[model samples]
Target: MGLEPFSAEDPIFEDEDVLRDSHKPEDLLERDRELEEYQSALKPVIKGARPRNIFLYGQTGVGKTVATQLIMDRLQEDQEGYDNLYVRVVHVVCKNLNSSYQVAVKLVNEFRGPNNKVPTTGYPPDTIYEFLWEHLKDVDATHVLFVLDEVDAIGDDDDILYELPRANDNGNVPADETKVGVIGISNKFTFRDNLSARVKDSLCDEEIHFPPYDANQLRNILQQRAENAFVDGVLEDDIVPLAAAFAGQESGSARQALKLLFKAGDIARSRDLEKVKEEHVREAEPKIKESQVRNELESVPTQSHLTLYALLMLERQEDLPAKSSDIYEVYEIAAKRIDADVKTDRTIRDRLSQLKLKGFLDVDEHNEGPKGGSYYLYEFGDIRPDMVEEVLRDVDRLEDLFQKEITSY
Candidate 1:
């Protein structure tokens, strides 16, 4: 008998992860400049000199991390050919490690036995540094490069940024010790400017900016991902281009293109269709938006989440962007209702900036013609109210408000 609910016959996907954001494709399409810079930065490891502290800043899905990882792997592979070049790359995605203290602890624990790893919290920064130094002192590699992806998550803490590059200067490592280099990657463009002056001058020695993908570039990327992800003749003629156009026109993000194609196939497969088609893409759009909106809201800082939730509430009655003033008013009400302290209006504006940079929201400054000066308005970027309602349902106090007010509105 044939399969019932899930078909055993050959489906569209050969490997679904080929389009995943985290998947490191064997070759990156349409990012030659970025790949060259990534390789250039790591070249110093071959000469036993410290690589420049590289700051790779760009929008999400623009291939910053992918280019870096490719160079990192290549650096390690090339080391085997030369006895003198010992490049040990310790790359960590520091998105979840919020502060300098937590980052320090994480580096130390990387060398620790699983059972003896340090706790997520507690322990002084100095102690964590000493332990991290202890791990580095014994490393046989000639150079160590710490690739801190999403480095902005460390907040204003300069300890890790300053100390890692100047590890030898601080006596944490010996003079002839393994020279350390830092590669900081962030989607937040202003994160580099917000870094302490000294950290900027040192840690941001070389900077590379990755721009958003255009429609043609997104098509190229989507074609490559589809090549690896699905069988031949599985997708209709309009599927890839439609998904690419959608992603390019909106986010200009390759990740969005890949995910859209994947989701379209998923919709087709679920419907038992012979081929993935444009109608399946139409069905996948809102589903993808809901998941993306929910994930982005969850990833931001706690205050950003509060601000977003407040904006969602303000837009319930009228599905329009609320001004900064209006958002703050609703934010205060939300804070009191949730038993959270209200942040200053200035701080709320900064939160909006952060959220906008991360692509969760959009900020528009409109100039009133004659008498009125310009004021900023905020809207959830491609985020729908129902997605917000879905996430807010998990919050105890917000559930009633979402059920009664948001759903109806």
Candidate 2:
């Protein structure tokens, strides 16, 4: 095989990672106001004083965590200049660590590093928390900052939130010397509201709400990103504004806007276009959605999606709504044909409900005759039957079943 040139000519991008959501720029374009407020919250850390616990709430793509990180970087830089103040920041995405014990284990592992990490499981909550406190003491950090991103994922098990902020004061660590601060960042307001009162009080000593960006704000964000992302004269005038408009109309997510820019550029590059244009962004939107749906379908458990497959077959093949009872009958046959275990009728119904909640299916409640109780008839919600069939065919055991029926419609 011939090696490609290291400096191949490219049109769409100067540096593509600039458009990635994970790529944090030196600063956000229009987040100066939020940054100032966030800076004030962390400024006390500069003087060797422990800052208040902070709860940051905002919709996705807003700059809650972004502003936090930028201020943290500033704080760290300032602390570096000081002789007495020392600061440590440990960031963990609590989505993957759902339980308090799991989060504590993650903290212990993060502090200890990979070679000496603890197991993800098998540790009791107390032991895990003790391990975390021990790591805190061992590091000798005068102040420890924990950024619990997507903290809603911790759900009802918010023991970590209740305890971590008070660890030093609670005698888990030496109270007089080191201070620990927790910053909880969440996209869901309901999750924050639903938190235990004790957890909320300790974790929300200071609260900030990051409102969704307006169209102009999103455009500014895209503009900052595009300054580094695309080469001059590559993107047409309408590209950034249109992407921002689309993202604004939906959720005003800067992440979505950035993703759109990346997707549009990617599409143009794949098609060997000279530059990214308005049409490229138009084409990229559906591709992004298709990819998202495929991923979401893949994440559903096989048994759960088996129930979905049954509904897909019923809804598409027979051109009818699928009742729980009818879906179970089809599901049992499909399960047996695929050499899989058939769940109980009740389990099948529960799976259907779960699939509905997952946005692949919709359920309509209906009352039959006076003697009959209400029943739910399932149909595709945001998902199409063809797409469901298409995605399910990716599973090896179900490949043949998703194909065209030999006997016709």
Candidate 3:
């Protein structure tokens, strides 16, 4: 019946924002090689030539976006001295924009600003592209570099990718007035690999790949961040190393490492502890993983959730690494329980493959020589079964199904 009083000034964190994704460090550590390559990719911009359409691909939490920001900042600042060159950098995050149409509209809105913003729909793709080109011309810059962050979210609909880089050649924008370029950033490596040949040839004029950090590199990054995030000496000696090791061993994600440090500090602060200790880091690991799994699940289709839930059922029954057929059976039952449509076995297999690609499942292909042929086995990947079940149970339609216990197949 009592609320704890908020502390006016107390320990754990000095500046928590530094540990977050939004915080852009002045210098990127341990990425000199990649940065050098990235600088080389952007060198044409400084010389007042047409900027290359740069493609940056890497796994999540690698410094792709951060590095792009740093280089973009430097590019803009350095270009200021060039009297003949007027450079403008436009950044658009395509995470929520799923298609080329949507991305073009987003760019149009970004270029047009608030007063002249257009609606999200109703415009044809060509019309949107026209609007984008007109806005690019109106900006009156000598060179315009558009940074499409999370460009993979546009998926296979890559019209913007193909068209943007060719706006000058295609005469959408006159080359003599303003030259346009694209700097696409993607966390998914497969996105670049799957691009159509024409789009790849246009958008990937210069490609830079960022490798994940190792444990030592992660430790160095953590130390740099912690120096700004946490109060001096409040973090135990082993705290940064432990968090870095957890993240490095798993995904080598700088974001995950920072999340662990932030969560551990949060735990310490909640307990009113003076220092973030090793135990706090250990305690934050599963929680961070669960949160990550939950966030990933939020984006997946409902059918993928059902497929994963089916796997969870098999995992609980110790029927792990079950075949797609077996998972299809469970998936049918679960789907029927919620009055959802039961997809075909082939569709379930497709879902399984997608889940595997998303790191939600581990798939093994079994070759059974002539007669037995080949089949695939499926099971949970790094994510735990309990975590999947817990997250799935939160789904409103599936909550009732989870209440019903199925002891047998």
Query: How are the candidates ranked when ordered by TM-score, highest leading?
Result: 3, 1, 2
Ordered from best to worst lDDT, the candidate numbers read 3, 2, 1
- Give the range of the ten consecutive residues with the poorest summed lDDT in model 2: 400-409
Q: Write the per-residue lDDT of candidate 3 for residues 1-409, one digit (tens) a residue.
A: 7997777675988889999999999799999999999899888889988888889999888999999899989988998888899888999889888899999888888877578899999977888988888888888789999999999888878999999999998999987889898999987766788899999899999888898899999999999999998888898899989999999997788999999999999999989899999999999999998787788776566688889888888888899999999999999998998889899998888888878887888988999999989988888888877778778888776776778878777
Among the numbered candidates, top lDDT falls to 3
**Candidate 3 Cα outliers beyond 4 Å, as residue runs:** 300-321, 325-354, 357-359, 364-370, 382-386, 389-409
What does candidate 2 score on TM?
A: 0.76
Could you give the C-alpha RMSD of every candidate to the true structure, in order shown?
A: 4.0, 5.5, 3.8
Stretches off by above 4 angstroms in model 1 are: 1-7, 312-326, 333-342, 352-383, 393-409
Best by TM-score: 3
Candidates 1 and 3 compared by TM-score, better number? 3
> TM-scores, in order shown?
0.85, 0.76, 0.87
**lDDT of all the models against the reference?**
0.80, 0.80, 0.88
Candidate 3: residue pairs that collide: none
